[model samples]
Target: MRFDPQPASYRPDPAILPLAPWLGDPVEAATFPRHDLRFRNDRWARAVGLAELSDAAWVDHFGRFAPLSDNLPQPLALRYHGHQFRVYNPEIGDGRGFLFAQLRDGDDRLLDLGTKGSGRTPWSRTADGRLTLKGAVREILATEMLEALGVYTSKTFSVVETGEELVRGDEPSPTRSAVMTRLSHGHIRIGTFQRLLVLEERDHTQRLVDYCLEHFPGPTPPEDAPDRDNPAVRLLHQVVERLADLAASWMVAGFVHGVLNTDNMNISGESFDYGPWRFLPKWEPGFTAAYFDQQGLYAFARQPEAVQWNLGQLAIALRPLCDAKPLVAALDRFGPLYTAALAKRWCWRLGVAPRGEDADARLVSACERAMREDGSQPDAFFHRHRGGRNANDELAEALQGYAAVEDEAEYWSDDRPETMVIEEVERIWAAIDRHDDWTALTGKIAAIRRMGAAHGEPPVPVGHIRRDRT
Candidate 1:
């Protein structure tokens, strides 16, 4: 238990987001590398007691002056427009990104952690708001691999490479600038309800829709939401039921943020930005993660319709603050709340038990007849059907002339270790799969130091990811 980056007291939410006079000031544009940190994993190993803090004291107390917590939300560098693939940029807001503050954690909640390439600013248009230690090691390996595939994402904390350098004529040599820190819950976008439904600004868009239904509408508040239901069209069916359970937890953990826009939706419907993100390691619902999306428009099966077209740009940014038959009933709550939160997050990542009617129309006709003919790689069809693995001759040569696994020839199955483990999840997935089989990659760091001598856990690497706190 050796880490703590000194935090008994460290305030910053000092506020200042009112920049929209056509946004111009924010341009310091670079800083990071008071010493670089390239440690790579164990999800920022913030080991036990958050290991005595340094890695440059987790960048000056978690997120260097995180834009000095912009005095708690009144900070407004906001104003936006999007439709990247459908066309219609009309310029955007938080361009190279910025909104570096808004605290309240030790459980009381209110997060927002921001800071992507802490450089340029005034909505960085001519480029270089700097961020590229290969995009901060691909957003610290895409937010700790989507927080170990559990999802509700956005939480890197600090990555800071920027030993300083930049050229990006689109990567490879001549690129280095970096800075990161995520944690989020409300960077408030969907284009801040599409810039208050395109400037009709009804009382500052109903005071930002009553500051997002007095802090996220969940454990109460939806008693059939306002008028036949219009608490801003049932908070857009509760942010499309948390962005269709965050695009069915990024289609059961193959993620691909690639840029969903409506200023990268968040107010709690997590999975913020990891730029051209990726992780399908084989899957391919036209898998994308931006390389200029070549018209796939944020693919991986068009990420729940690019998050229901950024929740129809937050029902056209909460349609001038509501009323036109509850703004088309809050844009019909993004297709049955993103198809029943992507069929209960794909029946809890393929353990598959949920099926209230045609078993979700036979798993969306076995995922659109295997993503429309011969579709077999989505991680080798879920590591051979849900990670059990056997490979049936590499799934009959990667679904050769597909009969779509010949109508699942009596549900061709396997990876069903009853849905991704539980009872001590195979003693931590057989110790990270025997530390990924054989040569004992430090045998689960010597069986967590002989189970940290009866569950105390402090053997240190900063007491290992506290393996989910014991």
Candidate 2:
């Protein structure tokens, strides 16, 4: 648990592009000699076998910003552009970040590892490449927590604080600097593909489609493989599926991304960039954490819709690659996929069988009504510690009561918790008393409570929860 402060060798990969004429001079830095960061705790990192990368010799061989000489990633800097919130921004891509090149672990799968705020690049338009320490810290926290919660996300490899200085409007005085690196499947974004397509460069678009299909591989199910010469149709379907699944995950977790801009949407569909994200303390469809989301474009409950909108942009970007019919078909799957995903996740959260065909639609609509009148707080919540009752039964009853109470009261607000809140939860479950199967459901519920009450030592990973069915 102690901080290891001994001096250590440091280095960066020298095989990198020099600063463009417009960019500022590069100031060199290194990861603190000791793997002093919390997430990279010498122990946990070792458990993950990342400790091998922590070795100083390996650092020289692998890290671009590691202390010592200049050993860096194989290929660096991906060139691309994006539309920021629907506005064209011709200049974008790793302005303060660089892909140090992909690295293979024991599995032989190459992981695209990269550093953020590692000094400036040609794209460093009007900004410093130095990242504020706090920004890096927040990113680490977000990644670790998300992974533990069962969401696929980028993982923080390391963060080395540059004891020196930089100024930023968002933080306190001259901010401390740090370089944060993330392990991702790849950095290709919807914007990366869209940028060239916007330039009307068909040849480049074709190449981009090939690259994405080979790497990101969107949703082309086996039977509907795209025409080989026609990679666009393939790429279109792939992205649509990934995007739908990603939206569903966000919905299940009650997360508001705050920004659903195309530039932030990755082709691989993994959620990246945690800026301005907030998890709902309790479910409320209307709540948004991103301060700039004035229009609620990326509201808590509208995430699926927001992602679909971003996918529509991708649809435009890839339009050159596919026929109109297939493109239409790919886009059409978004709604159903998102709905199905939501139900699957909701069912898991409640520990019950998925519902009747109309159940999901009705629940969502009911929540909409309750959100308006009952102060959008969730009628029921997920218990991470399992062994509780069947979630569906408990929640359905609670919601039924809550809605009845709201209707009887004849007035409501989505932002407030009223006298009816607790009453309704209790009122709704009374029906469980009549069911012959209630005993079994109640046993599961009681089991969940028993699990919750046991020593509150942190849970083992959900993957460890029970691979075998109960």
All candidates' lDDT scores?
Answer: 0.52, 0.54
- lDDT against true structure, model 2: 0.54
Stretches of candidate 1 exceeding 4 Å from the true structure: 1-25, 32-138, 143-160, 163-188, 194-242, 249-251, 254-270, 273-328, 335-337, 340-357, 361-381, 384-470
lDDT for predicted candidate 1 compared with the true structure: 0.52
Off by over 4 Å in 2: 1-50, 55-75, 105-108, 217-219, 222-229, 355-357, 360-380, 384-394, 398-470
TM-score of candidate 2 on Cα atoms, chains taken together: 0.69
Please provide the root mean square deviation of candidate 2 (C-alpha atoms, Å): 12.9
Worst 10 residues of 1 by lDDT: 457-466
Tens-digit lDDT string for candidate 1 (194-237): 55555565666666655666555453224555454445665665
Cα displacement (angstroms), candidate 2, residue 312, comes to: 1.8
Give all TM-scores, in the order shown: 0.32, 0.69
Return the lDDT, model 2, position 67: 31
TM-score of 1: 0.32
